[model samples]
Target: MTTVTLSGVGAAMPQPGDAPSSLEWLIYQSATAALVDAGLTRAELDGVVIAASDQVDGRAISSMLTSGPAGAYLNEEINVASSPAHALVTAYLQILSGTHERLLVSSWGKASETAGGSIQAAERLSVEPFYERDGGLSALAATALQASAHRAAAPDRARAEAAAAAVAARNHADGMTPADVLASPLVAWPLRALECPRETDAAFSIVVERSGRAGSEGISLDGAGWCTDSGRVAERDLVGLPHLARAAADAYERAGVRDAAAEVGDWQLHDYSPDAELLAYAPLGLCAPEEALELALAGAQPVNRGGGSLRGEAPFGGPLRKVVDAVSQLRAGAGVERAVAQIAGGFAGQFQTVLVIGRQA
Candidate 1:
């Protein structure tokens, strides 16, 4: 297996209401922060990977849209439409293949401009379009249907779910109550407004290099598994996703983790929604499906301790933030002996990515 090391990581999120700047400004801000974090000058960057939806941005290509401003003029670049996590995986493989040694991976989305529906729009394009768009199925509705079924098999612990939300919200500096979650208006059946993640604007970036002290610098990417399910919801098993289970199994084997629950003391979760995180727990083996709420609430397997995307709304930034938070937990050196940083894409019977990071051997 090819091991990839993280040399430096940096992220920039536009404040909740930063006056909109031209595309160039957005790209420059992100690139500067990232290069600085990596301890390299802009001229030192050798490669760059960009992740963003130009269609959603109402632009043609990121290169054309943010050219001189993005500092792409400073290095080589490639573009993809998936999550930043997706970009990282591709970059990791490229490095392992001896294609590139130093790389900057970034994804930026301005929810302020495109609004919050981009995730669903991007998701539908990846799957059988007829099943979702022609059927008029929104992601929330799909997740709600799944949540309803999950609750039927088990039961929704309103308090536990709320507590998990509270944990994420408070840690992120937002202090919403369990009652807030319970009373929040419904977006889709069984999925209260609070149960789903809010749409916030932000950008994310990370730097990976082939040469570095693995465990000493920061959390290294030990194992990564990403897969996509049938895009058509009707074609997928609504009850559960075997692909996720398979992905987790692959990651576990790669990381040499025999018992994830016992070995992983902390988790940085992408709980974009109660059901998504709830659905995620079992596949990752953090706990049994129904047991996730209890485990999360009791702090047994504390997830989204950085408040997740729920605490703050930064679409492209969520997973990157989760990775950074996990790295912090691993580097704290006080407690939290071990940790795993996890992120997902294509939820609701679609694409998913799972990454396990920790102190490398």
Candidate 2:
């Protein structure tokens, strides 16, 4: 396997007190910012890989829709059409294959265009048409089942909720209390409205290079693993995702990790819903799900130091921002030597992807 380095990272979003911008503008902003961060001109990019969603972008061919915006205009572009993490891994593989030396990875989504229940309806339609669509399986309901399962399986349900609530309070952007999180109206039995991520429109761009070939200011992109499970959420055991566990194991092995629970410096798991972070603990080798929540609330883990997705998140760009934030932290010398950016797609995390990035060889 060949290692790669993230040479640059940049993003665009609506600043506080500023009005929202077009998706195209956001993409352009990030694309240009990424080139600046890499200290390279646009002429150096050999190709581009974009992650996008047709449903979220509200278009037929999302790749074609974003070509100009993402700065891939006349260049060879490969669209992952899945999670942004998938696009990042694809770029890594291309570098490893020696077919490409430098690539720009980008992804974006604008939830503001179709507000109200339009986005929700489109998401519900993503379910298996024959098996799940008619039954109306959407993001909220799928996550609600998972939350309910976690609540039922825990030894001390109140303590678990309290721990999750404490972590939730820490993620409220500004000042927020545990009582506030607990008081929020329930979205779907057991999952309060505040526990869910606040949707936002955003875009992210990254530059990657082949091993031993990047500038001195980059972070190493060492190991990655992606896998998909049954899309039928009702069929799988909600308590544990075996395939996600295997994906984590594969990522850890590739990263030469012996004990992830104690080794990793950053845990950027895609906590899509309330307590979702707790559920991911054991699967990603952090700890028993029961203990993970407690550890997280007690300040024992680095899970979502910047509030994860709960603070503010992009609909299709969740994975993209995770990678971008990790890069920013690594660059800031924030006591992080290694970081894992994880994302999920499909039903109940039917697809899981992991990227283990570090500062060393």
Candidate 3:
């Protein structure tokens, strides 16, 4: 199988607002910039994978609207129709299958296009209509459930609060003061706005090519996996993300990774909420659940380097944004040689994607 390397990455981020540029325009800008970064022209890209969701985009068959802007006009193109991180794995498979030499992958989300209440409704709709939806499950409420579960499963609440607060404090998008984080209004019981990822208008792209022909400084998708679960939330252990844990375990096995936290130079987490990060600690092998405070409170990037997803973002673009940040960090200097990015979507991580990145081809 051919090796896949991350040859280039670019992003266009405007504060989430009623902006002037259309979503297509943002994609075009980011895609074009990525090609420039890769030192490749449109003609050199053999295929394209664009990620977006109709529900989020507020239109069906949204790819029909984005292909031209993404530079996939008259070329091979497919829509992951999910998180951009999933698009990366799909692009890697296309390369490994020897079906494409180079691919351009892009993803974006314009939260400003939809009303705040509407976005919340869309999130609630993600749950199963017959079961979970009727019980009232929004992303925020689901995360709150996970937070409560984590605390209940722990030996004591103080340790859980400390670890979770550490993730919130260190990764706050605007560097929100600790007092500000505490003062942030609660959207759901035990779930404050400060503990959640902010919505934004953003478009990001990356160029991936077969290793030997790709540039020397490029990072490669060493291993990855996507997982889904329907184990029924009511009976599930909300404190742990089993689907993500399984995905990480599968990716690690392929990458030959034994000690994930110790081996990785940097980590990029979806951290849908503060407790989500603490919940993922033991699963990702970052540290024991009880020891989360030790790493999280230590410093910036305790585990999530690039300030994680708390900084720049696109609502559904969390996973891909993580990858984009990792690429920037890897190319910047030495010391940080390997990284991982994790993204989950749905009620308490119904679907998950994990990617293991390394400097070597």
Top lDDT prediction, candidate number: 2
Q: Give the number of the best model, judged by TM-score.
A: 2
Question: Once superposed on the true structure, which residue ranges of model 1 sit more than 4 Å away at CA?
Answer: 66-71, 116-132, 155-173, 213-216, 316-318, 347-349
Q: How do the residues 1-361 of candidate 3 rate in per-residue lDDT, one tens digit apiece?
A: 5667888888888753545778888899899989988889899899999987888888889889987888898899999875677788899889888988899999888877784667778877877788667887877788788888877787877766666766776776456665676678887767777777777778999998887763524688888888877747777767766888899998898777889877888887778777887777788888876676566656544467647555645667545778887777777756887888787876777778888888773
* TM-score of each model, in listed order: 0.86, 0.95, 0.93
What's the lDDT for all of these models?
0.66, 0.80, 0.78
Pairs of colliding residues, candidate 3: none
lDDT of 2 by residue, 99-191 (tens): 998889998878787888687788898887876688877887888888888888888889778877877777654678889989999888888
Q: Return whichever of 1 and 3 wins on lDDT.
A: 3
Question: Which regions of candidate 3 are displaced past 4 Å?
Answer: 16-19, 214-217
**What TM-score quantifies how close candidate 2 is to the native fold?**
0.95
Residue-level error in angstroms, candidate 3, position 110: 0.3
Worst 10 residues of 3 by lDDT: 297-306
Between the candidate structures 1 and 2, which one is better when assessed by TM-score?
2
